[model samples]
Target: MHSKTYILISFHTAELGNPDIVFLISIVLAFTFIMFLTCEILLQGSLRDHSEPNDEYVIPHGDWFEIVSSPHYLAEIVIYAGLVVASGGTDLTIWLLFGFVVSNLVLAAAETHRWYLQKFESYPKKRLAIIPFAY
Candidate 1:
């Protein structure tokens, strides 16, 4: 996703040299880059990845399951949004926008549903999937 954003930025600015659009694209790219970096360090993987097979689920243990499970989806949206804003009113921009939204929605919904199934028997019965109460 990050590579794709970089590709779009390079191609568009090289071919068209639109300063204003390039500036906006640069802003989005910077923000998304920061987000990815932060997520990389802060995001804890699944409990099984961090712990022994015989270990029990507990306070900090559950936290290891997912700091934020849908990060890749989030990155995809940011990349496509950056592309759309960079391309302005082009057909590619519009199609990318639609595809991003639809794909994110589908993936987020499926992940949330899968999360519920996996965590149903866990201690944190109150923990809602995905977007807190909104999910």
Candidate 2:
């Protein structure tokens, strides 16, 4: 039901624009969708089924986790930025979109880094928490 609602919303919102705008939006949306799905599939076994309480906890089976921490939140930023870009070049929207992406990336990176440090004291010193290489 939730996924259905998301699809419907995307469809309706995608339609509320000029044909050219819609076409561009469709491309951005497609990119966001494909990237998200690909990431999910690639990290399937590693994803947790339930969200833990808002507290520090040891993540079991480090090998099995889709995101080191909060990839969904990052994806949300990507999705929204794509939408704003697709909606045409709105200065305010672009600024907000970029801000959202940067903020989420920063927060997710920090949280994931801390989790890695605590969850695996011996985690490969070279392995980054979120963005690969020099996060």
Best by TM-score: 2
lDDT of 1 at 82: 56
Where model 1 places Cα greater than 4 Å from the true spot, the runs are 1-20, 42-69, 93-101, 114-119, 123-133
> lDDT tens digits, residues 1-135, model 2?
999977875775666645566667778989988767755753554445346644555442343133344444455567767767765656786778678777867787688768777777765555455543435
Separate clash counts for every candidate: 0, 4
| Full-model lDDT, candidate 2 | 0.61
Per-residue CA lDDT of model 1 for 1-135, tens digit only, reads: 999988976887887677677787668778867756644543444333554555544332234124333444455556556556555647775876668695766577557657655765653554333433444
The C-alpha lDDT values of all candidates are: 0.56, 0.61
Shift in Å, residue 16, candidate 2: 13
TM-score computed on alpha carbons, candidate 2: 0.53
Q: Candidate 1: worst 10 consecutive residues by lDDT?
A: 58-67
Clashing pairs in 2: 46-64, 46-65, 46-66, 47-66
